[model samples]
Structures are given as C-alpha cells and as structure tokens.
Target: MLKGILEGCVLKVIFDNETYGYEISQKLQEHGFQGISEGTIYPLLLRMEKNGLIEATYKASVLGPRRKYFTITGKGKGELEDFLTVYKEMERAVHHLFAQRKPEADSEENTGFGEPEWEG
Candidate 1:
C-alpha cells in the first residue's frame, strides 16, 4: 500500500532541505512509516529520479564515506501538490465515514485497530 505512495513521502521529507539517504530513512522511521525499509526507500528514490520528480547528488562526508543526497525537483513538488488533493479527498471521505459513530469514553486511548474500546 505504502510502496506506491513513497514518492509522496520522500518528497514530503525533502521539502524542508536536502538530505542523505540514511537521514531520510531515519526520518521516515521516526515518523512511523510502517512498511518502509532501507531497501524500499532507495528504489523509490531511483524511480523518482528516473521520473525527474527528484534529483540525487553525491557528496563527500568529513567523517564517513560519500553520501547520496536527494532533493525534491520542481516536478516532484508539483506531484506532491497533486497528491495533496487526492490525499485530502481520501482523508475527508474516511473521516466522514468514521465520524458518524460516537466514540466510547475509554476509546480515546485506543485507535480501534487492535485493542478497541470504541464501537466504530
């Protein structure tokens, strides 16, 4: 599910500044990208490069080996903009569907996936 959406994820991360692969991976990990692995991240980077959505350049590190850094291209920015539309629509639809139910008092702590206290 997230495989096809990584372009958006990668672009979101780099929208702030240029970053190396390892840094990007660490950031994604911190953000709770559930299925993302280092193996999965690079290929998406390559594919994004192939599509001209992002550009990668290598730089020497002072304390370590050279690192490949990725930056979001104008095309990638435009693609992310497009994704925002789709993502917002999806979010709205999902929220609308789920918002119809009332949450149980104790369910605020549970997301209703594994250990649920909510009826929805």
Candidate 2:
C-alpha cells in the first residue's frame, strides 16, 4: 500500500510551485519513493483542493485530456511550513539517534597517536 503521509509530503513539496500530479509522482519516484501509485496521489490531491490547501488550474495537453496543475494556497503554505518544521526536527532527531559518536579516550591513546574508528 502507498503511504498517504508521503503523498501529502510530495504534494506540498511540489505545491511550493505550480505543478501537475503526474510530474509530481514521477519526481517522487525519482526521489527514492516506491509503490507510489497514481490511485493514491490523485485522491489526495482532490482532498487537499477540497480542503482549500491548494488550487488547481487546467492546461491543454496535446496527447490527452487537459492537465490540471496545482499550486499551494496561503493555507497550504502555512501547513507546509508547519509540516516542514516538524519533519526537519524529526529528521534531525532520527539522524542523531542513528549517528555514531567517538568513544571516550584513554590517556595513552589521547595524544593523537591514532585516529578514532568511525561507524554509522
């Protein structure tokens, strides 16, 4: 199943400027996402627009139906900022949790005779 949370994250990421869902999905795939189906993204886009988090404008598509482009609304911008803050803090905390730290040194080893081993 697709992660709805990541879908919203991707939407906000693209909604930072005008963009379409297909392009957004392709970018998401390129940006290390997997199992992100159009089924998952299209509905979320609709929901966000319904909630006034975004606005959609249609553009002509030569090969198919007109394409709809979405942009972040002021409300979406506020939400994106809040989401970005929380996401960054969580990312930093996770990084710290997963980060490796140097061990305390013994007096004999502390004279820059050798380097500390690194991991993670």
Candidate 3:
C-alpha cells in the first residue's frame, strides 16, 4: 500500500517541478512525510525511471558533481490521476467504516483489530 502511495507522491512531486532525489526527499519531509531517507527515495526513483513514468537528466550543479533531475512523463500523469481517484475512494470507505463502529468500541484498549494492542 505504502509503495503505491509513495509512487504517486513521487510522481506528483516531479510533475510539479523537475527535481532530484535529495530535493524530493526534502519536499516530502516538508510535507509531513518525516523520517523518509534518501535511501528509500533513490530506489523508488530508479523504479520510476525504469518504468518510463519519469525521465532523468544530469545537470551541472553549482557545487560538487552533476545532479540527476527527474521529470514526469505523460504516462506518469495518467497514473497520478488514477492513484488520486482510488485513494479518495479508499479514504472515504475507511472513514465510513470507522464512523459506523459502535460507540462502546472506542472505550477498549485494543488495537482495533479484535486483538490486544502490542506495546512496541
């Protein structure tokens, strides 16, 4: 679930502007996606590049080596649209499901899955 969502998010970021992996990670963090390291971002970018959802080009930076920037392709925009549609449906369904729960259910200290909450 997260992989797919992350793909959409990466696509959206690239669609908004051509950017590199590190900048994408920073934008995600600024958007409330904390703790997502560049390690996680590079793999996703590689996969997106392989799938032709995005294309990368090396550009000379003011400091250090060249940076590989990403831009979304037409296919990627379509995928982002589809992802948004499906995400909205799922969000509504989850909200409705929780809203229908019995009021007594809220008093329990369970994990909300018919089991005790783990103390991890």
Name the candidate that leads on lDDT: 3
TM, every model: 0.76, 0.69, 0.85
lDDT of 3 at 92: 99
lDDT tens string, model 2, 1-120?
134457457656666568888888877787777766667688888888998888899999989999999988888887778777877887799787645344543333435233536733
The number of the candidate with the highest TM-score is: 3
Q: Which residue window of length 10 is worst by lDDT in model 1?
A: 105-114
* C-alpha lDDT of residue 14 in model 1: 83
**How well is each residue in 58-103 modelled by candidate 3, as lDDT tens digits?**
9999989999999999988988999999999988998888666456
lDDT of 1: 0.79
Task: Give each prediction's root-mean-square deviation over alpha carbons.
Answer: 4.8, 6.8, 3.5
Candidate lDDT values, in order: 0.79, 0.74, 0.88
- TM-score for candidate 2, please give it: 0.69
Clashes of 1: 0
Q: Identify the runs in model 2 with alpha carbons over 4 angstroms from their true place.
A: 1-8, 100-120
